[model samples]
Target: MKLAYFYRNLNQGGIQKMIVNAANYFVEQGNDVSVVLMIPGGEYVSLLDPRIKLIYFRSLKKSRLFFSFSDILKREKFDVLFTATPSLNTFTVIGRLMARVKTKIVISERNNTVVFFKNSALTLSKLTFLSIPLLYRFADAIVAVSKGLGQSLQKVALIPANKIHVIYNPAWSPELEKQAGLPVQHEWLNDDTVPVLITVGRLVDAKNHALLIDAIALLSKKREVRLIIIGEGPLREKLQSQINSLNLQDCISLEGFKLNPVSWMSKANLFVLSSDYEGFGNVLVEALAAGLTIVSTDCDYGPAEILEDRYGFLVPIGQVNALSEQINYALDHPIDRDLLISRAREFSVNQIMQHYQSLFSTLIS
Candidate 1:
């Protein structure tokens, strides 16, 4: 199979990682795999497997215009086209109309469509969402990262229930294991007296970083807990101000985007995700893989589904007090470290690749 994977960029995100993993797996399995990045380029370009060819469609912006992608589709003959994100849904739909390649197009939704469009700029984002019944008409299949997200596509986007399939994001187990033996770079994290709490994601409103900060402030009053948030975004200044106001300068630290977060995850005593909503908490899986006792907000789609009673504790979303309590409880009665590692195996790269193999066979057969 000659598979063409389409994505906005090769950024350090779950969806991008999934696409890279799937494409690389397919290529290693003797299939012709190529990645077509909509955005020109970025740091994650190096992360793509050297074996898989890469192309950049510089003209493919996050807009309603379809000429650029349609032109590419007309020239490249692919057996299957796996397009990620809703922004490219319209492009794939239009490609089917204008392109010579009769590619079997499979569209995947990485985020909640309703939440994504709530503040989108493109007039067509709203229209494309409203016209999902028609936009998806050209798609061979629609893949959702979680069952909850699949149901949302059906309920909110009006996509047919029969057309949406749930496939959770593959875990970062391989990377975690690889980095486990690596030396810890941060001097502050070399100590064992203080419990380190790590959160990995963009510092955004939806991520609810403020809540995590509040919870950390609450935790600081009693215990020796150090919070390290990885990733940079618009919320940095606001979050820094909150940290200063709460006098959490010593307890909480914002270490903006590290190329490798696995080292931090491996060193951390605990991992927590406080997102208000998530399609699939990829970082939570990474944390679990790194064998950290976990605590997460019971977000709409992922945390409750991933972190069951055995693996970690889930508190109600936006409840900083409850989040703080759970963190304290986990710290006091730490879960069996080996058991957490054992549970993380369920999301290993080989296991997830096999799932993708099965889905690809089923979709293209």
Candidate 2:
């Protein structure tokens, strides 16, 4: 099958990572894979599989993407097209028609559509996202990364239940072990005596890192556990201010972005998330794979799905006390390392690839 993935760019986000990972997986399986990006440059361009073709319709602004992308689709004539996010998904529907191609278009809702549109920062975003119900019907299939997200998509996108299916992202790969084995620079990460807690993601309002800071501050009163926050964003100065004001300078260290975060996860005793919303908790799965005990807010779309059964514990979103208590419990009562790794394998690349392959096969057959 000649498969193409349409995305905004090669940016360093969970969706982009999945697109690149899936494209590579398809290529490895002897299918021709092409990554179609609206923009040309991103940090993750280097991470993509060399066997996969990268088609970047560069210098094309929003107003012009439809025309430019349709031209490429007509020429490339991929057997199937996978698009994530509303903007690209909507465009894929238009592009396919404009190109008059026979490609099976699979629209993937990467985030909890309801919560996303509800919390959209701009009026235009909210209005644009509301159009999903109308545009998505043209696609060959609709995918939600989690069952929770699938339900949300059905409700928010106003799509019928039969139109949606759940497919967990390929969060774990065989290569992850090699990446986890990569040497980390931080001394405290591997130090068992430190009792470290780790969280990864951009410092953003949606991530609600401030809540995590507050929870850690609550824990610091009675214990000496440390925190390693990976990734950078605009919230650095604000988060730093909160840490300084709380006199938590010694307990929390914003390590910024580490290319190989699994190395840090490899040593951390616990993984935490205080996000108010999540598309899918990719890092939670990564933490499980790294054998870290997990505690996160029972936030919409992802945390509860990730924490189902005994894999981890989920506290209600924005509840500092509950989050703090769960963190403390995970610290004291450790989950079995083998069990965490085993559960993580449920979302391994091979498993997710099969689900995607099933979709492609169905379309071709």
Candidate 3:
């Protein structure tokens, strides 16, 4: 089978990592795989498999992106292709129609479509939301990263229920485990004597990182602990301000994006997710895979599904008080690391690749 995957870039993001991993896995299975990028050059570009073909559509002008992808697909003639992101899905749908590409197009939804629209600042997202029901219905299949996310997209985007499929994100691999064992030269994480709480994601508004900072302050009142945020974004200055105002400058470290966060995860006492919404929380799975205890907000879509049945603790989103309490509880009572890791294996590369293999096999046949 010839498979093509599309995304905006290979930026330091979970979705990009997942695409790279899946592409690598499929190619190893003897399928012809090509990864298409709208714009090239990102932290994760080096992570792509050497066996898989990579194509980049450089944009001298942003308006031409739609036709650029269409032109590529028309020529490649893949058996099936996958795309995620709302605006790009809209583009992919129209591109397939205009290009008359024979490939079965599968578009994945990566956020709570309704909650995402509620927090959206982009006009592109609004336009894409309007096109979801209309354009997405034309795709071979629509994948949501979680069950709640799928239902939300179906109801809010007016996409037919039958058209939506739930596919949880896969966790890390042996390569990640080896990376986890590598040395991390951080002063705060140097010693396990102090409680260390770690969180990984872009420093964005939707991530509700400000709430994490506030929760850290609330947690500090009870005991001594350090906070490590392992991603960078537009809100860094604002988050730094929040940390300074609380005089948490000493305890909280805004460690900007790292190519391999598995090292930090290896040493942390606990992992956290403070997002207001997520299609699925990939970092939580990474933490679990590392055998780290976790306390995450039971946000709109993902965390609860991941933490259910005592696997981990889930607090209400944006509630500093609740988040504070959950963190303290996790610190006080440690979960069985082996069991936590056991749960994470359910979403391992082998398990998830089989899911995609089935989906693609059905679609191409």
The candidate scoring highest on TM-score is: 3
Q: List clashing residue pairs in candidate 1.
A: none
lDDT of 2: 0.86
The per-model lDDT (C-alpha) reads 0.81, 0.86, 0.87
Residue-level lDDT for 120 in candidate 1? 73
- The estimated TM-scores of all candidates read 0.93, 0.96, 0.97
What residue runs in model 1 are displaced by over 4 Å at the alpha carbon? 58-65, 119-124
Per-residue lDDT for 197-260 in model 2, tens only? 9999888888899999999999988788999899888899999999999999988999886666
Per-candidate RMSD, Å: 2.1, 1.4, 1.3
Off by over 4 Å in 3: 58-60
Q: Please give the lDDT score at residue 118 for candidate 3.
A: 66
TM-score of 1: 0.93
Clash pairs, candidate 2, are: none
Winner by TM-score between candidate 3 and candidate 2: 3
